[model samples]
Target: MTVFILVSGVFTGAHVWEDAAARLAAAGAEVHAVALTGLGGPRDAAGAGIDLDTHIGDVLAVIDSVGVAAGREIVLVGHDYGIHPVLGAADRRAERIARIVYLDAGMPQDGVPALAAVLDQSLRARLAERAGAGGAGGLGGVEGADGELPPPARDEWQRWGSTAGVPEAALDRLTALASPQPLATLLQPLRLTGAAAAVPTTGVLCNGNGASIEMVQLRVGVGDPALQALTDPRVTFFELPTGHWPMLSCPAELAEVLLRAAAGEGHRLEPAGAAEPPVHLRPFLLDVPEVPRERAGNVDLYLPDAEGPWPAVVFVHGGPLPAEARPTPRDWPTFMGYARYAAGQGVVGVTLDHRLHDVADYERAAADVAAAVELVRADPRVDADRVALWFFSGGGPITADWLGAPPSWLRCLAATYPILAPLPNWGMVGSRFHPAAAVAEARALPIVLTRAGLEMPEIAATVEEFLAAAKDCGADVEVVDVPHGRHGFETLDPTDESREAVHHAMRSVLAHLTA
Candidate 1:
């Protein structure tokens, strides 16, 4: 239960961390996003004159309402203006927090107002213009008292308004509203103290001179963000080459960096590591003569245990071919993170050499999955009520069809990045191997689908199709979108949460079998 709560800076919503949040989940950390009060969206009950404490209180109430996990410490991240609110949260719930990260955030001290105390004169003057009519005189510094959105400055902000390249409709909605700030929050200095500084802190600075570190530093008289934090023992820093938002421009890379910071895991850019050498392919075998073997039609199987009977989890590999041709072993030395985890959790793992099919004809492939399931059930230890399957990448299509109409041996299904062949895209016509049909048959069972969070946007449509299939089939679907993670995350050293999620999905199916 390692929780990472990310707070947004001014003029942003939880949507800001959309990319990075997904990546963190893929890397195995539990992540949540935060919206500063009066920033992302209005609190239903919030009114004007909402001071800094109210904002901090707003965020704290959310944390309390959701409730932290049982034992792990939470990580608090504050960006720009959000520093005040998180610091206040830490003051009250420090025990729940393990570390605090600031993304070029302002540091406020006791009895000090947040905005006025940190902003340089240049920023203050610029802000004065945007402050409504009544806000002109309220501003502390040098500009004449007219709080108006100057055409030029407003235009500049508008240009860089969105991180996801922004949609025109959203841009219109945001531009329609000009936010007003409370005089108290603007004038009051921050209330930082010795106690809070004692906690762990990390800073990420954008050296590209965009909005976060560079832009602010350019306006305010300060050096780079990471360098500034170096003097503080509690704070660690890193520089990313981007303007303001790294999530929009480089989600995958940034997510890796965040994951490294969280798990203390290895961090390599796949420099020489992206692809394995030739001969990375080979046949993977499961059953051993030492262990009791269950013979089923020319196939020798290894059941997890020989007690009464345990649920079977037939593992399918991608690349349509015979097991001997492009063999898929139960435990592959090259990479079997998924198998290692599922098997460790007591699932009777089965590795199959699949049957071939026309490149586009999935019905043939679907039939192969059916045959494999039948072969699996022939074993004595395979509990008909608890049997499941874990299908990898391209193998998903075959297994998806099996789940829709699998033998009694399969009680559940786990598909990773399966292709919804029923869809009309990619020149595909009405598919005979419509997974929706099998879903209808297996509607009563639990199904877990894992997909990469940062895949092509078109994948969303594919997912929608699957969701429709699940709904039509009356199946229970638990879709875990691994954020910032690429396809085939099973091969990597994912975060604990990511692995746990998969395990939980498996356990749920197993538990339901008994229930």
Candidate 2:
């Protein structure tokens, strides 16, 4: 695999991405750090003539220089100002591209210029004033200085603390190599076709600035075209804790994230674990006709050592592993762990693999869940009337059918850090995945909802709206608050908080069945 690391322009160089590039290369990926025209090295003098097209050509040239062919897949990663040119290049060569990653960068759709898409009026005016003052031909410094903007001074560095989490030494090198950005590049509009839309994309959001996907969605509704493409079904989202300059501040973490993205992993909000199942339940596999059209995997059953006619819970995983992953049973360690935990509680725990090619597959995956529920019910070992659906992150929407009019067999529904909304490419267009809609479709069945304290704004908003609607309808729902938690915190980083949340979720599931 090859990853072309595109650096932000306006005084930035390939050196800025050195750590990330090195790490990616170490992970067996062919890495190329492209320096746009007049942006790095002594070529800063030639930046006056560099336009948007010039930088676009620079990316294409680098692709050619790297000798990427049709057979080998390549991942294109763009950071900050680099998003535009990379998109332009990706538009021209989307066929050979495997995935495109926007690292805390603008996501401009066709016809929108990168700068106009991301910059607010205040930031625009600041850049303009800085560019005009600088005699270095329409290039501005970070601090809005005139004439070949110098390295960031003490105050400027302080201001960048949240955005650039690099150490002092790295920051020094950054300013030392900082060059000038071409004004034309910012003004240039990008042209693209439907081809680029087909490429799977990931947005590595840097939460250091307090920006979240929920905020991005709000911006999209108010005529901000920059985040427009992110609303698409094919684009997945991830978050990093560092500031804007993750390459310098959190290179190792960034690299690991990119590797997972390239391999079609981490699409889920959190990471899976490798914990072994409890000793009481033994794992057994039952053969079933494979579902047609890919995304069909094994169904493992965890039966308690105690007795028959036990309550059952079907565990559905999130992260919808990409097609490129060639996933095996091992890919879902977190869900398997959950199944084991449930089995340890004397319940029949089931972990299933369903088709999740994209968000639109929610309906298909739901069908699979129904099938699994039927299979579990038919088994003499499980209680036919005591079963529930347990969904996580990407699998949250699969509960739509159950939520609308639950069957007599399903005792309750349990969802943990679920994306229970019709956002982007994860669910069917008219599906009842929206919490408000699901809650409105009244049913007597009980429900358990868990919310992360440090939840992503999008999920947080959905949860609040759901709870409000549930309360208004007087639905039988239990709300569990995981204070000091995050989205998918259970799997990403196992802590006392996550453990407590899981226990609460299980408790809620049990309370309904026993009641």
Candidate 3:
């Protein structure tokens, strides 16, 4: 197999791909690590004139030199910002290109510029400010030789650009070799025909930094055209455990993945822990206010004072009551208090009441929750990618669909002493609220179920059976035991133990969001 690898933006050159290239060569594939113009040491007046077309020409020139022929396909790979130009080249040389692989990267939509499409509005404004402040030949006003953009600030790069697993030696080398990015490259919009669309594509996502392919899907969904281009059915998706820079952290594994893509066997990702070690949540900000909403079923928003794209949770209260007795969003004082607590802890908390006039109303509750999710995602304050569901008491089974086959956006589910099974008394026979059976359907999505030590016999037995069955099925689930507690302890019993249990469960859910 013939392969071409393009490195991410704000980097030196082909040196970043050394490990991956060497590994590919060892695997009997011919690899080309092409350096784009105006990057690395081939600096011309700090790359004042280098743009998207220049970089595209650079890859095309490499392909011409490598000499592609019929039946000898080239596997074109790009990481981060490098993906933009690679897409351009792939479209032009569609015949010789067998596959296009994007490594923790974004794809080009017809008219969107690379940077504008990738960065959120806030971040884009910041970048624009910095660029405008740059000096002559520098991006913004930050200058480098030959008019190139300057590298990121040390603190910023350390926090966001680098990862934990990379060796210190590699970090030092990267820091030394890192070059300034060119302004024109990011500002230039890509032009493409249908040729690249016709070629097979694979998106090899880097999940080491707590960002997964599912999270990316949630971030844009099928709604955003740019994200849809990379996530459509024609593209294959896989996850890598290393941070954004997999070439430096897990070269051998990365090489094997590329080889598999070349062989038409990269459709499925390697099992989560087989190729890369899994990550768990660590206690960080175990750490929040209330605001009322008038519309969307009278939902109330409890928010933190801090600016956020904060991980949010939809708190569903339980009540299988008559129409008049049923609580509206304005009611549920206990849930509202909990939502306020969540806001203080930097989470966007929503306490919305679903219809519960009859036993069968639980089915409609799911639809209500879905609507809430869409509403929360549209808010600028919430991190749509890291949202979760929290069901209390009767609300538990109502969210069965979300628990079993959750949308990509849901990070985890927390059921506080929930009524998970369809009880003989509820009078809803043949209902699909069997959480035990639904465990397998969740795949590996994280779930936290809180068990009240002192529970009614029937509910206790059902909870036990569900936990056992979930374990047997290898589901990623855990039980938070609240010994000496009764149902709704978090809200009803304000003792130290009950408070601690609620806090612990909330923290765990936050950890899952980050993970």
Candidate 4:
């Protein structure tokens, strides 16, 4: 028999796992759902002193009480913020833990606080700013004098995680039962002794909340060292079709998946060996002549040979790129190729490096882009009044700023395999970065969008949603479809369709710039 210990996320307690716990118990497993200190209880039960160590102690108590029996194994399951305590406990009892399951949660590193796992960008930013300035008092200020953060209102629950597929009744119950979370819990850094790395791990990705097996594979394929470690045989993945709160939305399925995870049965990601460069790092697909290059601060300019003041196309690279990504986006072959290719077609091509290293850095990235554009326009070799912006991948969201109110000098906009909407797991709705909603204001600005047919479903969905919104608003948009292409197809797929789509998109943008 296997003993299962469940830990719920912020603002809730063991009560949130009632349905899943019962299901697991019915399947002949001994299940224990831990109610961490200051959560999943009445308001008065929480106090200012309850921090992460308090929650870790709660889980440790449960583990100790549920002593190991003959032929018995223990599986620890942590959901969302619950993973902090689970990891903390497991680090101390690595030999006792048979496996650890991460349910729709980030893989937190030692010395990093749970604040990094928060999906609400604005909230995280505010709290981080406070933490940096006030030291211990900084986070306390945001949580109120009581040092406890109140549970979100019923309507605001989506800020915590995706609410898709959750029943109305369950949501109501969750809201009513929610407890205030101690502020210190999120502020306290998680300390781990390296011993827990040996424990087998299972990641339960919730696809509806933006994480999926494909996404993980995509990151790994990009040669990300952090994600590459997941290729280890000890780490496996299982995806849930429902939202973040799977226990409430699909208890039976959650139970089944939990069982499978405990048994170490799940999909394994293949290693994108370090021998060869990742596809994005590969040489550009186009064979255009190299153009004269000039660096102006963070911006790189590829100038046309026979130009006095050429119309410039500023190509913005997509990412929440790894902070440590080698060569940076401006130096990446695709961007360099696009810049040079644009110069070949009698235009100045601009590529820039922005601080979009994390999802929350969109504002900073946008500012960087704006400053870069100002610098590019001021250059004597570029025609300031005939500039176009072309965005790719995650950089697509920044287009929203220009779309809502295009400047007279902005000739056109282009996007390739872009993410037009805020991803479900980003914990954002009606955000300023949502380009799908902003497309309506781009009435006269000609827009060129390149789409990949075989793109990841999550990303493809955003493109489709944007197209639909554009159609509804009657925006002047042209679609260039690559039927046999994938996201980052310029280098990943390298098919004739990919090459033709790239050429078509560039031509369309150039025409708009010249018109």
lDDT, each prediction: 0.53, 0.67, 0.67, 0.88
Candidate 1 residue runs with Cα over 4 Å from true position: 42-46, 66-71, 117-120, 123-154, 158-183, 210-229, 264-515
lDDT of 4 by residue, 1-515 (tens): 88999999989888889999999999999999998987867654577678899999999998899777776799999999999999999998888999999999998999999988888877877777887887545666464546767788899888888887899999998998898877789889999998899999999998778788977786677666778779999999999888889999999999999999988899998887552777778888889887789997889999888947889999998878777777788998999999999999999999999998777788899999999999989988789999999999999999999999999999999999999988887866667999999999997999999999988777887898999999999999999999999888888888788899999999999999998
Runs of candidate 2 with Cα error greater than 4 angstroms are 68-71, 117-123, 126-151, 157-161, 213-233, 268-515
Error of 1 at 374 (Å): 96
- Candidate 2: tens digits of C-alpha lDDT, residues 1-515: 55555556445778888888888889888888888877775346543457789888988887766655655667888887788888899899887788888887765767866555433333454555655575225444454543333444534543322444668888777776766555667766788886877898888877654456544443343223334455565677777866668888999999988888777654422111112332112232211122111122456778776767889888877644454443333234566667777777777778777776445466677787788778778888888889988887667767777788778888988888876665421213344656567766757878888878888754565567678878888988887888787765654546776777777888789777656
Query: Number of backbone collisions per candidate, in order?
Result: 21, 9, 17, 0
- If scored against the real structure, what TM-score would every candidate get? 0.40, 0.49, 0.54, 0.93
Specify the poorest-scoring 10-residue window by lDDT in model 3: 277-286
- Candidate of highest lDDT: 4
lDDT of 1 by residue, 1-515 (tens): 56778776555567767878987887667787875555554232223556677767776776675565576667787766677778888887776667777664545667755544323334553554545434534444333212211211334442322223334443454434324344444544555555655677666654432223222221121122323333444555554554345555566766765554454332111111124421223221221223344445433455444365666666665533332432233334322444443444555656655554223445565566667777667656666667777776546556555665555545667776655443222122334455544566674666788776744333344566677877876678888777755444443435555565565655665565555
Candidate 1 local distance difference test against the native: 0.53
How big is the positional error of residue 429 in model 1, measured in Å on the Cα after superposition? 56
Least lDDT summed over 10 consecutive residues: which range in candidate 1?
Answer: 265-274
List the lowest-lDDT window of 10 residues for candidate 4: 136-145
1 or 2, greater by lDDT: 2
